[model samples]
Target: MSSLKPILLVEDNPRDLELTLAALEKCQLANDVIVARDGEEALSLLTHRDPGSGEFTLVPAVVLLDLKLPKVDGLEVLERMKGDPETRHVPIVMLTASREESDLVRSYQHGVNAFVVKPVNFRDFFQAIRDLGVFWAILNEPPVTTRRPPASTYAKGV
Candidate 1:
């Protein structure tokens, strides 16, 4: 099996999801692209500790998160992931169609690695996703995380 880590894509819109997937495919990235239709699903894929107890655990190479989502919002998801030691080191890029400045500010405040406004035109959006896929998946080298201690340990500053 390939050691390449998968990419978590959290998008609720069907068309947008399809387009993003296609763009990533065009990028020809070897890493798998996992889909999470909502914030809840994204959180489950990222967090879900205790493998023996049957909790889901997936630390993706990166997370492309949308701002507006069903159930839980992206900012909350970012906050939770950044707040947790298990997933904080994982990079997250906010990919959204929202032009609101507040959204951008809040995303940065929540520790998002990058914030990208989804382009309106088809070709632009496609190229944007392709560039993002190539950069984050193929070009960017992530930090090696060999140790995964319990969250409680970090709470005690150990």
Candidate 2:
């Protein structure tokens, strides 16, 4: 399926980022992938509003976040996003190499939608990312919101 929304990838490691991107590309998912090298950059992108439209620019179908990052950790980013009304509905997946139990617990506590442990082997990593891409970008169904007319407008029309 063709996805209009982009996928947000917040990764700090260059090699991992390269590998992840390559894996996603191999999957041939139609959605565009936006990369942020740091937590600050990710937050900036997530919160940035367009001057003309007054709407946020970084609405993604899914967010693949690394646990460890510079300037602000992934947990902090996840917390901020979950706390914000506008961003709370966006699905966030913690994609990290860390296997600490505390990190997993903390991520779920902070309201991460999914958690994926990065595989050490190149082939395993590639397969894992491809599966993630296919599932999130293709199979997952997100909540749909419908716009309603204001009371004043409805009364006037009536």
Local distance difference test, per candidate?
0.84, 0.84
- Indicate the residue-level lDDT of 1 in model 2: 23
Q: For candidate 1, write residues 2-91 as lDDT tens digits.
A: 356778899999999999999998888877788999999889767766656443346677899999999999999999999988789999
> Which candidate should be chosen as best, given TM-score against the real structure?
2
True lDDT of residue 19, candidate 1: 97
List CA RMSD, all candidates. Answer: 7.0, 8.6
Q: Residue by residue across 56-104, what tens digits does model 2's lDDT show?
A: 7557778999999999999999999999988899899999989999999
Task: Candidate 2: list runs displaced more than 4 Å.
Answer: 1-3, 146-158
- In candidate 1, which residue ranges exceed 4 Å CA deviation? 53-56, 147-158
lDDT of 1 at 123: 100
Pairs with steric clashes in candidate 1? none
lDDT, candidate 2, equals 0.84
